[model samples]
Target: MNNTALLKPETARDEVYAAPLKDLNPAQPALFQANTMFSIFERLRAEDPVHYTPESDFGAFWSVTKYKDIMAVDTNHEVFSSEGGITIGDQPMEEGPLPMFIAMDPPKHDIQRKTVTPAVSPMNLARLEPLIRERAGKILDGLPIGEEFDWVDKVSMELTAMTLATLFGIPQEDRRKLTYWSDVVTAAPGQGLIDTLDQKFEIFVEYHAYFTELWNQRVNADPQPDLISMLAHGEATRNMEPREYFGNVVLLTVGGNDTTRNTISGSVLALNQNPDQYKKLRENPDLIPSMVSETIRWQTPLAHMRRRALQDIELGGKQIKKGDKVVMWYVSGNRDDEVIENPNDYIIDRPRVRNHLSFGFGIHRCVGNRLAELQLKVIWEEILKRFPTVEVAGEPKRSYSTFVRGYERLPVIIPSRL
Candidate 1:
């Protein structure tokens, strides 16, 4: 679909947000293209925080816009079930239920989640920190000093892919395959990665076979510290069905890839766009942790997570029927003025910095969030130690999906050293 056509006249760009609440459709790709998603979210937060869209390419769904409502829905997993799926787009029925823990309800979700939590436990992150700093240093030291480059490619994806490879115990030579499969998992046809469902399926089969080989290698070996090993030896996860195993792999890949990579890219773009905040960070390098939190909130790597109502419920003055699709717009929630002071502004020193919906809320919140934050913090620390200023050379090209709030490319130039 040509989203640009939805915006008939570029002259009326301002009016896009002024459309009636009932007529407003946040799912249209044009809003993100115009970079006017904030305005739509602003309107929804004020007038219809729990707004419902009757039609969309995905389906009819309710949009939960405010931070409070999003939290309410997110935390109450029993009432707002995740069993249907995490994103708004329903999985193709022919592919069967990808029973990854993220989409499971209750005992199963808890069990599978426990199996992998140790990989990201505080002790593990502490052990991984020095290695992350080493990798970050090397990556930054290798960047071209004065020439323009795609920050998303040269830095963001590279670092995240390297870290993911470490987490999965994938051989360094074969690590790029993880990145390839991760992109394919979230990509829609014509999204610049895969062009058709058949191509996607082909890649899916390849991904499954590759992981199966890894699983076989680890299933019999002495227990290791990697994700595949954890799943292989875990009492709860060891006997998972084929589709369930594939689903877990997809969950870990997409979860780990999108959050960290996009934030890395988004941090640069955000700081560049907000020069004052950038200046503040350079002056006080200690602000990196706060800046990381603010960037995650501002970027909202994943835009929304969908839920299916298990029972009829009333929320935000609207009645949601049983089995209705409800989407918690984290992008919108992070910018909600009632919750976040100066929500539109990117302030690295903002108080209560961690108070945002980026990592999500409740039991289903991202398990790898601390590791994601650690990578961002370490990269920024290394970036500041090297370049005094990393300038945005051009506008960013964002991912086509409303689900992944991220960049496909971010052009940047580093102006000498500090």
Candidate 2:
């Protein structure tokens, strides 16, 4: 029996509300609507690779969904400038250019990135690996085997927070404050944090005041080998004003918190979803590095990066005027069929995993990509060695913000010991 034929006239109308695929036009609200965004991307990747989406809430923007198109925009920083800011929706806060490095176009972006890049270099990350592993083991050791726990809070957030604390040399007691400031700064209106622009700006002011004290202390004290000290003493960074200092602090806070948190939470979710993949890694411990890359690709935590058109440019036969906001959907790009073979499938040893844009591309590519990778690798390596099996105990809940796609809560149960 055909279900469509069996449905009554009224039921058919109800079906219209349920089926997003029924609305195919790019201009339709369904394109930018949260419920339909992913589905729309899947459809565009199959049909129209570049689509224009206009929304009352977020304003009009070109959604670059395909792999090649996203790569073109992300790598060509000259044509597409990040200085316009990266949020897709209207920012409630009214302030001057917030002075974050991610919001600058080169050669300024280059200079700022170079100042902090050395601190997260492979050699530096290598020195931190053992410490990261020790922290991971300590966190996992505290959990009772075969008992359900919120993995997002207990494992993912804790690990990333501790790692960031180590990176910045923040006191352990103050680490949770880092996570709070990060949430407040990046939280959107719908996320249940501060709703208005004034509140968000006020939060920023408070954060700046706190960091000012920290900065003063760091400035007068003997120099140490941490991100804060490096930024304080680095040739390009020493001259930064209070606003600029706060901006960099906010950048590192969000970067170290959200990306690695999602990676850790997403990896556990991925493993639980694909037990075969989990079993594969458990059997072959050397696969941790590949697994790390695959996790970043599968998660694509930084869902999209926004850019402003510097000048008139034609992409995919569409002419974009200067100052037009263009959003590169890295989440969709990672799953593009042309870039990764069997893009949607989770293959731990997939050879092209590192080619993913989850960390992004070109000049603004993640400044701490190596550190993020090191943290994930160390966590997984230590986890596999300590526990024979770790499984999801309940459905994972996602963060509300589209900008930072991650698990807010993940429940899991692990074996007592190996």
Candidate 3:
């Protein structure tokens, strides 16, 4: 929680590796915020791939690092259940869980997930592309040249907010509220976003009330392309309990926001860090699709997804007891040397770039993946057409949460217009 005063890289790595394997805990939000968990995950992947920490901010849980091991956990939804929830930390006991499809199992998860899938289907995305490109162009055109600006705020968030508003059928004017609610849902107490868990609930109440009005409106009207209308008209989700609706709302908002938003920021930062790859992109624009996938692998926006053990299982030679929390670090798995070649470097044109753990595997794979790619592809295409270069002018401030691996701010400069 707000713990990243920005640790020195060498010291952070040394401290993490020096600690005993038994005492290592990668779930701490501070490690993520400081961007120091790379070393922790590195040690865990090397020594204890299926690691258990007796004590943590979230309590005793198992960390599943490495590429193949993460795939095993993510794909085997039956043995590694999502019903216990998809994050290492438990929700407030009083609030209970807001049940969304991502946290459900089997028949129920399939039904609810199917209800909202059409809104982001390939056909719908093709229909939405021209509009998205137009918006991306407008955003790029509006950016001030020869001055430093936060790409996260001025570009990444704005573009994603506009696209999210279009998908949810909300006014573009209310887009920032979507960002706020999404942030609050992932925020921890004392993280600056929220002071306490109660405050988070209060924001949830506001979020619920706002979205409920939209749901009622959609339910009363005929079916349309927006997500609200789909949920209201779909046979499975039409009569969902109010809290369940809110849960899906939370899910969709974060789903749409984080992957695209963070990856957009990450793409900019990564390209800046590796100028050679950025130069390759300038010479060959066709690499955008491959570059998008590379950045997704490079970023792994949502770092980890948690699952619960259905029965006692031995994974990577560790005995995982029934009901234990198993956290699959997708971020770490993307870095496993045995799987991805030159895993630490940002290579935009890497072979089999799409074959990464960023969007996950199996049934729980991200629903909005293609749309995320479409947005990135269009933005980069438009970006190349106008600006010669968008340079990262200063260091980025990463988000506070362990769940959302994203930037709070990334300052950039548009040196000139093409």
Candidate 4:
């Protein structure tokens, strides 16, 4: 019942963490810069691959920096539970508890994941490729020529929202709401347009109302081939509680919005920054698959995922007690020198590109990874077909939160109709 007890230990750890934070500067204006947190990650990965930071805004957490450590923890899910929650810091929600598959450990996690796996299978995604491509084409067709535009708003957000709209069978007009709800839900403590606590609840209330309507409609309507229909009609899903259903919707909405949106915006930014790689991609469009993987790696959009130690464990030479919070720094691990060669450079044809931890690793890896790639590849191909040049017209800005790395605004100029 005492929050102060929690505060004392964390404050002590802060003194230790801050000492090193002062010596090392890993912040990069382009790659990572909003806060000096990432700089600390880069420092620890170099000095101590598996380091513990006693103090953080989220309380004390162990920062897992190496690629191997992250994979080891992720694969050994039995010892490290996802059920305590997947967030590193304290969550803002006052709801009793949120139901998300990402927050459940095995058994429950396995069962929950199975409920929606059918909808995202490789075969299902292949069947939807043509539809994704058609949507990508329409998105690119609407962009203005020779004038600077915010690519994040116009292209990246639109592509992701449209693809999700198709997947959920959400009407076109309501698609933007997906982006809104996702921002409010995931908006780290002080980020985004609406910063007040009450404002955050209002947004969630609206999303709940919308999803409630959709759920009621889907329950009565003929079974369609979309995700909503799949969840509604599936026998497994019938066992889910109302909160669980709400959790799935929230997960799907956030998953659909942030990851894909960043990949698209990050891809264009990477291409512009590395013209040589962009030239290679433009010439050999076949390399788009490798490029997509590289872009995910280079961007490392979803920054970190938190895991709770279910039992006492020794990881990377450190002993972790049960209930210890472990934060996997995907952004830092993606650039681990040991796992990735010349990790800082953007290599379009890097052979081991698929080895990156962008989609994460092990059982809880991103469920919509294949779909995200399909959408990115389609959008890139369409852009190449229509425009020969799409260059940054101004400096791009990044989101403030450490969780999701993405461009809040990316100014770009495209030559007249290629």
lDDT of each: 0.88, 0.79, 0.90, 0.80
Say which prediction, candidate 1 or candidate 3, comes out ahead on TM-score. 3
C-alpha displacement of 104 in model 1, angstroms? 0.8
RMSD of 2: 4.8
TM-score of each: 0.97, 0.90, 0.97, 0.91
Clashes of each: 0, 0, 0, 1
Q: What tens-digit string does per-residue lDDT give for candidate 4 at 158-259?
A: 888987887888898988889878877766545556768788888788888888788789989998877777778777785578777888899898898899
Give the per-residue lDDT digits (tens) of candidate 1, residues 1-418.
1242255445344665556668677886555655666666777788888988887888899999999999999999989999958988977647565778999888889999999999999999999999989988998999998899999988999889889999999987876788789888778788689889888888888899999999999998999999999999999889998789889999999998888999999999899889999999989999999999999999999999999999999999999999899999999999888889999899999999999998888889999999999999999989888888999999898887778887889999998987
- Alpha carbon lDDT at 38, candidate 3: 89
Tell how far residue 163 is off in model 2, in angstroms.
Answer: 1.1
The alpha-carbon root-mean-square deviation between model 1 and the true structure, to one decimal in Å, is: 1.8
lDDT of 2: 0.79
What number of backbone clashes does candidate 3 have, counting pairs of residues 3 or more apart or in separate chains?
0
Evaluated with lDDT, which candidate comes out highest? 3
TM-score computed on alpha carbons, candidate 4: 0.91
Write down the lDDT that model 3 would get.
0.90
Q: For model 2, what is the error of residue 221's alpha carbon versus the real structure, in angstroms, after optimal superposition?
A: 2.6
Off by over 4 Å in 2: 1-36, 195-198
Order of quality (lDDT): 3, 1, 4, 2
> In model 4, which regions exceed 4 Å deviation?
1-38
